[model samples]
Target: MKTVAFVPIKLNSQRLPHKNILPFGDKPLCWHVINELINVKQIDEVYVYCSDEKIINYIPKEAKFLKRNPNLDGDLVKGFDIYKSFIDTVGADIYVLAHTTSPFLKSSTISSALLKMIESNYDSAFSAKKVQTFAWFDNKPINYDLNDIPRTQDIEPIYVETSGFFMFKQDVFTKHQRRIGFNPYIQEIDEYEAVDIDTKEDYEFALKLIKTLNENGREQHV
Candidate 1:
């Protein structure tokens, strides 16, 4: 399949100003996911979709740069708007939507998600974290009984979707105008791989985590 992956990012950030370009470790925060995507063997091409030309310097030479409309960079613009614009610009059999905030997402994990969507009956697959602890929604207890309480592990696991990545067939996205499909598969990821650096606290914590990973030889090289 003609698989193409893209990382959608902008200079304007509401929290942690310039978080995308800020140094996460040796490289910029956004560089990690881009490097991982570039290493994916199944991916035919990797593109950094950003409005700022300066971002070209931050990304690796292997990945192509696609300048997008600045209007889509606004915080108010929905993510679907960016996907629609990019999908219209770049034609592909498969589209992998990745984010700069998810620096710890691994290439192997990404490859697994894409492979599942490609080889199976699943139309789309996205990274998620499975939580077995007690959860609540709208003042109502979830995964628990009012009369009886169960251990955290005994409770049914709830899958929480991460901003890590989303892979979908072109037809599924174009036809439904959504990243997810009717037959979606969840790619469960560990807490370490599920890290998303959005706020200042998140960024700080991620910095420490990356350092620890690298020290422990857990970091994968491209």
Candidate 2:
């Protein structure tokens, strides 16, 4: 099956302006996702879907730029629409839905997730961070018994919203009309790997983390 790694980027960010183009370490944040997709052997192609000319120019030569449709570029339309638009337009057998904001994702992680999904015959798979906490809201327990909050280790593990990446079967998506379908699997990742850049604070934190890694000469995977 032909697999295309799709990244939907936008110039206007509500929390942080021009966030997609923001620098992280030696390259822009978006480059992290692009690089990972490029390195993944399963993905035959990489598409950078966006309306911004700056972002378009920033994309590497290996990636194909999918000019965003004007209708789906509005602020009111959800980001899911953009993903759907690309999936419909490209018509690939497999689609890897990725975000430019997540710079810590490793190419190996994405490859492993894709292999796992394919081998298991999963319709779709998304990354998450495992949480083992008795979350509460308004002094009431949300995901666990009220008494379980104190005994945190005993609580059942839950997958938190990581939003790192997704591996989708295009055939199932056209029928389901969403990234996730009837058969969905969760790929658990570390908390740091799930960091998404949404605000100035988020950008700063990511930059600091990247800088620390660079200074330590740690093996960079993303």
Candidate 3:
């Protein structure tokens, strides 16, 4: 039914200061995600939640802007609380949580995830990357044991939440107080699409990857 995409952004960042407004490929970093969400046909509306008023200049006219709570503006504030605030204010049947860090995320992927959630009767859906490589924990092999080493292809794939985007029914948040519910679906995306800009190194890597992809004539779906 009715779905809305929310892009939560803040002015302060610990690792990469002022990263949300940093210069990305063509425009500011967050603009890429904002524009993508606005273009998605499945989404009825797109909202930009930010504390800074200056961000208004970057967001397109098609999207709406909402001021974030100043109390939740600190770096130590939990993201779950911020999301709860959004839910409490802007009511929607389905909410699509997206991040500016994932600049390469595509509108088609967002639409696909939402469609899958509806068709499959999933309470929630999130973007993830399929991981099949060997993993270790507590100084021991996790997926494979030293005694038995199997081919990588034979190993079962694990899905890692990319935090790129999430689609969930409002009831999911009301019941679990979180974006993900008990019956959640994971939409697998490629590693490149899952890239999250947290640090300077990550930003550089993403820029380089974007440049390389463009050079190869690969059109970025977003």
Q: Largest TM-score belongs to which candidate?
A: 3
lDDT tens string, model 3, 106-135? 888888888888788798999999999898
For model 2, residues 1-222, the per-residue Cα lDDT tens digits are: 788889888877778988888777777778888988898998899999887667766667788888887677677998777887887688788789999888898888889888877788788889999988766669876677654355667777778757689888886777777787778888888867888888999998888887787789888753
TM-score of 3: 0.95
Candidate 1 stretches greater than 4 Å from native: 217-222
Model 3 lDDT-worst window of ten = 213-222
Q: How far is 13's C-alpha from truth in model 3 (Å)? A: 1.5
Residue pairs clashing, model 1: none
Q: What residue runs in model 3 are displaced by over 4 Å at the alpha carbon?
A: none
User: Per-prediction TM-score, please?
Assistant: 0.95, 0.91, 0.95
Could you give candidate 1's per-residue lDDT for residues 1-222 as a string of tens digits?
Answer: 799999998988998899899987788888889999998999999999999999988888899999999999888999999999999999999999999999888999999988887789998899999998888999998889978998777888899999999989999888988798889999999998888888999998987887787889985531
Backbone collisions counted per model: 0, 0, 0
State model 2's lDDT: 0.81
lDDT agreement of model 1 with the native: 0.90
